[model samples]
Target: MSSGAMSQKMTCDKSQDRHEEKVQSSCKQSPPGHMTDLGKEEVADNGRPEKKCVEEVQSLWTTEASGSVKLRIDELCPQEPITVHQMFINCVQKYGHLPALASKRKEKWEKITFSEYYRCCRMAAKSFLKLGLERFHSVAILGFNSEEWFFSAVGAVFAGGLSTGIYTTNSPEACHHVAKDSRANIIVIENQKQLDKILLIKDNLPHLKAIVQYSGSLKKKLPNLYSWEEFMRLGLDIPDKTLDDIISSQKANQCCVLIYTSGTTGAPKGVMLSHDNITWTARHASRAGDMQPAEIKQETIVSYLPLSHIAAQIYDLWTGIQWGELVYFAQPDALKGTLVNTLREATPSSHMGVPRVWEKMMEKIKLEVSRCAYLKKKLVTWAMSVSLEANLKYSKDEEKPFLFNLANSLVLEKLRAELGFSGCQKFFSGAAPIGSDTFEFFLGLNIHLYEAYGMSESSGPHFMSGPYTYRMESCGKVVPGCRCKIANVDADGSGEVCLWGRDVFMGYLNMKDKTVEAFDEEGWLCSGDLGKTDEDGFLYITGRIKELIITAGGENVPPVPIEDAVKRELPFISNAMLIGDKRKFLSMLLTIKCVINVETMEPTDDLSPEAVKFCQQLGSQATKVSDITGGKDKLLNQAIQDGIARVNSKATSNAQRIQKWIVLGKDFSVSGGELGPTMKLRRAAVLKMYHNEVETFYRELKK
Candidate 1:
């Protein structure tokens, strides 16, 4: 068929049929002259839309009339539309002998090739089918980043079911909400701990058919429960043709994965992502990041972040497959400190870290340096100063200093090698805004931490910073082929960031009203983040619209800038939360930097090495949080007041200045319900948790 003929046919299908109307109502129609960049005429043989498959997938999403899903395959995608199965097969065929996944088992790394990885996924898929996984049903995976987690997710998609990952930190009720919401047919868990959570709510999940534990021994055997080995063997007798037929029927436009939001405000909403959303975004995003193809050199990456998050899933699973990158799974206790160990061994080419991860790394490095010998400390400090000056000059397009190379060779390179970053080409930070302190710290070591900005609704990356396009405090340019515009711009040109591309998700699962609110009439995904773009198209996020603090005086203040300023002024501060929404004046809640119990992952009263040094420099003998808070050390108190006064001096207006502040006994943490799984602050939860403290701030002010 000719291009005109295909357009006419699609238009007729949209206008003449009721079902087509329903699909078109929810899906954005291709504008005239919108053509693929393949440089060849699209024909029916070139992966034309399959009506039945498209409708089947569209049925899973809920979208109001105002909302739109991008389903125009020919125009939106540069290459031919392809399913996940096809993408996986192409990767295996090209790099079958290459190492695809590596996992440490009993202190030895076990490697799996692409061919073996494909075989394992098929085995898992057949097992899922044998276990009675119905089409469109979900395979809910609750686990860490492991081979088992990868198998469960890919197998579910291969078996014609949606793969949904539940955060391991979720409580039983939270797990139940996701499982029931997805109508999960099978639950794949890491061990007995996750299984116990499911068992508590198994009776409530009507669609649940089986439970598979991938690690650890089961405490008690149940009829529906099976071990990983046992489950893989269940479908051995199942014919390959059975799974093949399911794969053949799958369409690129169909939903294959469900990523639930962190739900800072309320219950989590399931974000439906199509196969094209995964495959296309993976390919294009990799291109945007300047990732080399497997044909040239296969990149290596460490997978430690939660797979449930879109960023990790895209980078580790989809993008890894696209480029045949070797992915090494970190230990289950990766966040507790084992991550650097894995990074050292893996020597990955690319790595991604959340802000907290980078911050922790910065804190660790500083603490270690503080304990170094006097000469060594001074030498390292001098090298860092040289590197920092050079990098700052480079950022300003000025020539580097003459001693930069010497400093990098003598100290900076050694520091990076110690942190397992010697082989790292690109370092990325996302999921939360990284502080300027952390950014500058890494930059001082000649490490450029690229910042990316996006949401699950945009299939991970909308704006990405790269080596050539990087700018300080900017999220770089929009990903190749993606479109972004600031909506409802204010006087300062900051507004809600809107995105448009194939990367935009289908819609929310079973939430039409919410889905409608997600997109504007022009079919752009309305990112609730407030940001502005520079002349060079680098995006800078200011604050979240929902997180903006509106005072009683009707002044809207972005809390992040103020909070970050406070932390920058007071290096000992761990977290600073600006609170003045609908209140008389702005007040802040702060947490001092302290040691954390690795086992419990909880904050301890004992001050961190850096914090202790800060106190000593201020002529205070404080060693623990109690030493300062209880004893009310005049030096420490005065130091804090002076820091806040400095921050207040820079405020644009009096309304934005924090009037009162108090340090909390404990720091915020994910387990404590003050932060989400990604370490992003849950503002509503924090407010509710500290209601009394906030009330006291205002109450005492009146007194």
Candidate 2:
């Protein structure tokens, strides 16, 4: 949904009687627990060089349930901190002078040291106090991933309040919905653009107390709106001891952040996460990520992913604080273009991307390869085959056959560098399922890409590809502190992948009924995702239980994996929807990629001469990207036949084959309501929106 569609301005400007949770800290702090999880390296009182925190005398006993447990990430680290603020304080004191946060500004990288970051965080917290926000209240963070954003969130934490992030792409109405539900008292916005959104629905948010913006251009227009500087300036009068008192009184179980779910089926729910949730998760994540102790302070990572999601919290915010790692923030709106450039320039030690990022990168590379000269194309193809063959062997725990290393050094290594993974030691994917074909492409490039499985309920990923054991086709082993189990198995062994872990979220904030439904009686988080575990302990997802397509013969078919396979066969097919539930035969709905004029930036509803010739060879007329969906256009239908045939050939029965199919008039888009806010397909919504078109396919099948 576009901001314009919802509203041109933000909503809210009211006061409410807010309840504050104040902890009276009478008990003295323990004689400093064994190790602080806040990325602490003990400083010697006698000038002996510092070490990776203080080593304890406790026995390093291994757990009997090895399968459920993972390698200990940090034994010295505490299991939980009274508050995330305390965790941050421990880290800031240990690495006070180290670079904590950095961002690219005007083509230059700017940084703030841990000390400066702490100061800013303190000031930001004081600003909230200056706004008269009650403790335990929420401060909605509305902005791109930036230094100020992180500072503001941490500041809220210091003031003993919950920090909630709203997606930068959320429409104004969605923003209003979140604000209203979260009961956000103050919103720290990025600029006038976002400020305008709050203005649109301000009247509806009865609890919203103030609007604070980083930009000062609109200071004169809205008298109540305060500039970033002005807001922090208000905090100068707030004694530093005030924030210290708040942080000192924070409890471990208190809600520290409210992370909203993707809401594919309905309205997004606020997932309440406590301080322990993040500190515990980040500790395990620190080890699972395989950050060598030597590289803990030296490593640099880019923060380009959506900050609203749980993944960014673990890797960018919480993890950065835990390890004292340098974080580079990508420019807003220019993330795609500059991310690649910055990767090439900065050469980060670790990198992460979702499926869409890899998918688009592959499309760009393939397009360029198509235009390459015959000899160059042939050489590139042969080189990739060699790497792919080697990767296949390596994945099976076999050594590279012959001249494999030579092939990598000759063609693959340079290519990896070009795509910005040369220096990247840890490249992983999570959030959603990545296509097998896409995974292989990265493997072919010698870029060992791995997949992980988790949700907002798990505090990001409690399971990921560890350094020692990893499989290309499965989500890796359970991270430490998380016990994984497959429940209610079928004949095929597929079942709901369930988990119980310290890293799991506290629960939904306000939805009592939904909270009960999220987990089973045993407290295992019922993921709702259907999958099976292999003998090697690797987990392979079949599909969503709610999304399973039961054919007329009663055979269940997982559509996503099949759709991904079809795309692997034909790159032109943008998306495929397998329609066979309760039907005599299987069918599909596909939407091709959008084609636009390079210069004009308008939809080119005319196919290129070369493109037309390519489709002509497949017995289909040329069609533009815009014409492939939204209506009945058979011009490109035949062109996708080979791809469909490839999928059908793999099917076990006739009911699983694509007996009929059609191209949609548009992409499965978030703004179009075809996909959910998180970009996951809304099956029910999609079907309802195209009921007439979908029914026609079945009617034709009847004939």
Measured by TM-score, the strongest candidate is: 1
Residue pairs clashing, model 1: none
Put down candidate 1 lDDT per residue, 399-492, tens digits, no spaces. 6766988888889889999999999989999998999989989888889899998999889988888777789999889987778999989999
Write down the lDDT that model 2 would get. Answer: 0.69
Q: Give the Cα lDDT of each candidate.
A: 0.83, 0.69
Scored against the true structure, residue 5 in model 1 reaches a CA lDDT of: 25
lDDT of 2 by residue, 478-504 (tens): 775567899999998999999777676
Candidate 2, superposed: residue stretches over 4 Å from native: 1-82, 293-297, 373-375, 396-402, 551-555, 582-584, 596-623, 626-636, 700-703
- Candidate of highest lDDT: 1
